[model samples]
Target chain A: MANERMLMKGNEALAEAAVRAGCKCYFGYPITPQTEIAAYMSKRMPKCGGVFLQAESEIAAINMVYGAAATGVRAMTSSSSPGISLKSEGISYAAGCDLPCVVVNVQRGGPGLGGIQPAQSDYYLATKAGGHGDFYIPVYAPCSVQEMADYAVKAFDMADKFRTPVMILSDGLLGQMMEPVVFPEITDNEPEKDWACTGHGNKRRHNIINSLYLKPEELEESNRERFKKYEIEKAELPEVETYLTEDAEIVVTGYGASARIVRSAVNAARAEGIKAGMIRPITLWPFPEKAYAETVETAKAYLVVELSMGQMVDDVRLATSCKRPVRFFGRTGGVIHTPAEILAQIKLIAKEELK
Target chain B: MKRITVIAGHYGSGKSTFAANYAIDMAARGEAVTVVDMDTVNPYYRTADLGDIFEKNGVKLAAPRYAGTNLDVPILDFDIPGLYAEGRNLVIDLGGDDAGAYPLGKFRQFIGLHKNECDILYVVNFCRFLTHNAEEAEEILREIERACGLSATGIVNNSNLGFETDSEIIGSGRLKAEKISALTGLPIFCHTLPDIPSCEGIDREGYYPLTVYIKNVWN
Candidate 1:
């Protein structure tokens, strides 16, 4: 059947898609760039027969998500940069407890409450260490409205399938922008919640959801089990979109909104007889390492672009194992780089490296 | 035809989105269109963000001087007044709330000089706060009108729930639009749908099919 098309902002699309994905509860606090998600959920959750609560703080909101997810219901919480910092402890706890939940970090400029503008500076925070732990949550960085809607549903499923938290890492640009989106039909076969904490019904044993493990050996075992799931995810869930990568000499790579700019820059470079391509990471944590490895076969040099000060460049370097000269271009503290700026950079890179 | 249109509403009411689409539509119709971004209140979601989209469609943009720059200050371009000349269609995307509408007071003289050819449209989204009902919507409308020193000529019902909007919600918004019209004595200029002729309960004349331009990378 044909999907339904609608015009929606990124935050609102994420919220609505979560509800349609059979998400039963939403817990979020108000923060700029992402406040629309909570506001959208306020009006939509009630109508969908779901729970929507504005918690006292971002800490409370993510903890509420923990509580809801412990019960095996599709639960989520959204926040911006500083707010996500507040949610880190609970995110770590949810990760520790092996509870499934979706966390949306519609990132803003920040090392502090920097600004209410878009930035991808949260790359390390999301990929390396979102909280005080060694656990990694699969992060989906969408570059369009359609992906935002599609990833919301996919994030929930990935969370449940692995019994771990999954993040939809977006920025202010994606959160506030409006676009036409076609939503897929709601899935009919929701996975059964056999391990839910539903009062320990007569047929099943009591399920204890806790993160604490005084025993190092038990914690080590738990960590090992989680890593096994991560290994599976690495093989199965690394997503990237390659644009004009075939027989190209310069490859530009980025994620989220920066990737969108890179696409335009690559196209403009191609129009001017420069063989430019792009590798857009759809999943930031898994990092799409193989895609970079494959691109390196034809591409001579790579330019890593972002809205932050070269955070994802490290990942790209590692993905290619520093086989080629991987350079970086970005702006921090809420500054957005235009396509013209990126195109100029690409032209310069081609002249310098293609020699 | 010469026209000066102002789109104003509360934050999250989709006024910027509507203005962007309206400008694109007019430009596609072969009119010499210029869109002014008077939205200093919202630094992120504004017509300024879609300068490339407007330029690609042959629509001229008159945004803040510091637009697309790092600074978040409101610095209107000197050429804004030139956009109001005869025989060109101009769209002014006003900021949300009364504070956002205050910028329009600067253009009061220009609007008054061309009052017969000008229209200030109060875009309403029934799903947004402070405009969920007729009473609340009218209150905000009065505040915007008082700030701009011009009354709303008509109401554009751009009610939506993002991706969840349907015919039932669109049909329900018509009642709220009628109520808003009743309270303010304004005609329902049009109802906006994401796709035209495909959605039920919307007829041809009073409905506009919109192509949403100002969108982020995600939906």
Candidate 2:
């Protein structure tokens, strides 16, 4: 089927993909930057004969997702920053039960009820396990509208493949931007229904899906097994795109919308005498470490720029392992740094590195 | 000091009626009391609304203006205008149970931040959910505390059989109160009646569920 072309907003693509990927249930609150996802689902999902519940709150929305996902059907919920914060407990529980589900965090400014603008401020909260335990979710950071449309299928697959909570770590820009996208043709991926909580029936006994493990040894075994799966994920799931890295002396790196901006910055920098390349990590949690393995060889120093105050810098620093100094340029609270501003930083980095 | 008391319980447990009486009593005592109608589940129980007597007394009623409008957003918005610091009470009349209590989660972190002035009273009906048994009551209490981020919760046995509530049922409620007190270690602050001034209250009011009556002709 010659890929159908359509002008699509990022949020609309996500909702459409969720349907095409066999996601039948959706629970969400209407929030800015991501309302189109819910609105699109509300109209299309009902027509598709799926369940669309505009929950009492984000907590209720996530809990409803938890309930539906526990039954092992494709269930999802979407929200922005503060709303994502409220869903932390349910997300952690999903992780604990090893349930395959997707959480779309269309991030805005945060720490509190922040502004409804694009921001990658949730880099830490999304990557580092929050909410009260040692559980991790494979976080995917998509840069373009194509990935936004694409990952609704990919996230559920990755989540099922790992039996982990998979995140499409997007910001307001990716959530709102309209672009050309080729939606995946609806076909059966045929997910395994063995572990799902869709009623045990007479198959054997009750299949209890819970996070609580009362015995210490029992909990210890689970924690160990979860990490083992994470290790396998760490080895396999690294993604990035490198532009002009052949003889580049300085690397400009970011993810989500910041990567799109930094890509523009790199194009501008190459026009100048500075050989700057942009490395965009599409998968954030099982971070694209392989791309950064030879950081000292290709680039003298890596500049990690983002909308939040040096959030992704921590990951880049660990990936580089201090072999080369990783400089950070960031602004907090929903402020977007222009390509011109980032190019200026690249110029400064070229001056210091080439010297 | 003015107290910001949060009255919370499960669905159909008379939380709003109890809250209304408490606010009215405080108002009648010549004290400035603000009653926020934070019941998101049922809008009809809201006593202090747009033009109600409670609103007439600057009661500051904050209930969801309509249904299905952002359920997670607290039904009643909170506005503490130097009235409370001046020794006036701020009583937030909350909705029932975990589903009802969810909108309050956003305020929970703030409650932890304050931790001093705000007090949450888990309004228990010896009638609803796990409150009928000691173990069930303890589990419900634990669930409420965990969900609400509340370390301390006082109880109010609003265990009346609606308009027909009587003394014997109240006695059974007292038995529940004793068991709950032992289980959760929280004291029963008060019990409620259905404004029954003289006649014995009914035993089967609970059997009468609140049903919506739609006006119609034969179709």
Candidate 3:
């Protein structure tokens, strides 16, 4: 099949990409900002010989995902912030049981059903264990509709490769926005799941999928094994995009939509003779520590921008080990900062640093 | 080409998608096209989201003040009035439902004066809820017209199952469109199909092949 170019919404594209990536089961509940994913799946899944089950709630949806993933079928579930909160317990179980699955959070503002609009306040929740565990799920933040489609497939692949859950952390802007995208040709060469809980035949022993371990030592061993994988992921899976940072005096950093706005801000600042560049972390989990450390060598100061009140700023600080001052600028509760707003912050930083 | 084309329908009727493709089509034919995003009710899918497509195709976009911003406020831009100026081909992508059509009531006087030069199209999709049949579609159409204080000049058959759509589905929609036309006394403006190689077996006039501009992110 040739690559086909089509215009799609971020949420719709994510659903289609999962189907094309051989995802056999989709369990999701409708929520604002992310409802299109469930809607799209409801239409496409059956046609593709896949399961499109809309569970009664987000809690049931994630648990259904767990069941499908335990059977070694590619499975996924998506929700917004409040819905994700409800699914946290199920997500923790999936992580602890070492099941491979993809979870999409088309985030909205929330300390509680804050608003049904774009927000990035789920950074801490997503990067740290969103569920109640010391486990880590590699979170991919996509800036464009194209990347939304790309990352959905990548999340599935990464999840299976590491035998853990992977998250595509998107916001309402990316979830709702549409863009032209070229879909990769579908392939049927997914990795085999040797430990899958298919009925154990005479050739193999039964595979039990459980998060609970009776003994403390056994649970500790499981934690140690997961941490070993996390360390490997930190070394292997960190992804970032840097623009004009070679001789930049000031580097603005952000992820997802904020990164897109920051790129425009950097361009505007450059035209005005301000040496501004950008470092966009594509994978929020690994934090792109090496990229930040390398850019800090040339960049004198950093501006951490987001759609929330400076959640990712902590990671940016730790990435560079506080080598230079990291300033924060953002709006919370569904407020989006414009490129002009970001450029003004960059200009202020340049003035202070150049002096 | 009509001087002003207003595309209106219920939610999920693919009105914004139709307006974007229509504007792009007009621009491709060398017309000076400007698409105004008059959608204030539905925040997610709107013509303003296609700014890049409009820019690339040389079509101007006049959107609401908070069209692409994170704010959920329904503040329309002041430049909206400029879209009604004569000479250029204009496409007005209205919001879904009667509530979405409320803003158009304010422009009723201007539209009424130039009604002959404007085309208010009621786009119908049988696949959508509250419009599964001709009677239901007609009721919603009257509601929208009453809200906007402007009568629909034509009916556009845009019924489909998104990417799952086929020629047979599109052909079946023509019957629903005919019923809507009969009940509303409106002419069939066009029958829309996804832009694919072969829409075989279904021979219908005004077959407008559409390149879907508005889509869910994971299409």
Candidate 4:
């Protein structure tokens, strides 16, 4: 019955998936659009023999995850945009210390607690820059509630695989929307954590979990080793979902919730006899440059859509290396882009290509 | 039918979606209906989110204070006593369980005065957490009743798993709802079905087929 199709909100599905994925510890604070994750964890975690802590604040919550993750336990924390900002320091420490943990940012609008509605403004923060450090977190953008559930499990696996913090970049719309989702089968395939800070009891060499490396040469070595791991991560990850791009003139692209709207618009354009296609990046950090490369010759121009003022647009341009013109259209402050509006942009691009 | 209908349920029980559709259905029947949203606990996907839909359908939506804005603070904006005194058809969409339904206690005196005219309906979804069984459903119903100081007159079997709902889900949920009905001695008002094509074989008796208004754009 657990695998049977059931309707669930994105937040609840993510929490349930985390539990099934062998996540032993969860720490979170209450915030709109993402409070359901904490609420679900409160009820389900204790029943499943997992620890759920509602820390005093967002800063406290992420530090709690850091402590739990150091002991080789699967620990995670979730929050909204403002709360994610508060957790940035802890995330940087996890990246520096090579502590594997999951961080979910079910983003709401923001510059300063902008709105309770959904927005995709945190692309740059999650991918290119997080806290003050030379680090990159694996960022996944899930488009539907089902993917929200699937990616929560994948995030934990990927985090442990690379021994780094993995970020699931969701938005308010995906957080609150309801859809039917089938949960994945539970597996106990976790790798042994010989580097964990578990008590040795005079049996073996004690493990040290730390982020401070004062020696300049030693820190450079640490940074270089981490960059080598990131190179593999970039090569192994970076998933993209493409639609009708073989002979297309204009390709529309977006990530997470905005990509759902872009897919609909691309379909509408195809129906109207325009050679429009879509390329949705499922991984934000890697940017899926290979997918863009495959379309560079066939697709004449690119249209990037988003819920913010075009944060992911910069990635599209860089991925294409300015070989094609990339246009950006977006709605900010929680206003979502309608499919009709995106279709109109595609129409304009199609007509201009005639010249 | 009662003049005032109050819908209460556990979290994610589809109460807001049902209340929104019920208000529109009443408006279609030429009733001057004003649906009041008192869900301050959970911010998103409440009746407040469908303000434009309600406006287009000729239904009045009275959302909470500071709703539809960036502020996360909870405030009851409507004058409940005035709405009760206005003599229009009223549908109050309460928040989940006792926490979200606590605001309804302020209008208890008005509702008690017109007890016969008020129909406090408890919506049930078997798939939701904390209410998967008859005993669990009764406990939540009693909690909501205690929080609002009113007894539920009816039980609405609104059991569906979003867009994946089908006739089999409806049947299984009805069986569970019937057990609760037997234990609590409340009548089953109606079984709600999502307006999907897979429900062709579903029985139409006492069924309320609804066009799901709150949906993802791609769906």
Best model per DockQ? 4
Select the stronger candidate by DockQ from 1 and 2.
Answer: 1
2 or 3, greater by DockQ: 3
TM-score of chain A, model number 1: 0.98
Q: How far is B122's C-alpha from truth in model 2 (Å)?
A: 53
Model 4 docking grade: medium
The residue-by-residue lDDT of candidate 4 on A1-355, one tens digit each, is 7667767889988999999999999999999879989988988899999999999999999999999999999999999999999999999999999999999999988889688889999988899878988999999999998999999999999999999999999999899887788898867767999999899999999999998988989999999999999999999998889989998889999999998888889889999999999999999987799999899999889999998888988788889888999999999888898999999999999888635
| Residue A100 error, candidate 1, Å | 0.6
Residue A39, model 2: lDDT of 73
lDDT of 3 by residue, A218-251 (tens): 9999899899999999998999999999888899
Q: Which residues of candidate 3, in runs, are more than 4 Å off?
A: B1-219
**TM-score of every model?**
0.74, 0.62, 0.71, 0.95
In angstroms, the error of model 2 at A245 is 1.5
lDDT of 2 at A88: 92
In candidate 1, residue A199 scores what lDDT? 91
**Clash counts for all predictions:** 6, 9, 14, 0
Model 3 chain B is weakest, by summed lDDT over 10 consecutive residues, at B196-205
Error of 4 at A57 (Å): 1.3
Sort candidate 1 into its docking category: incorrect
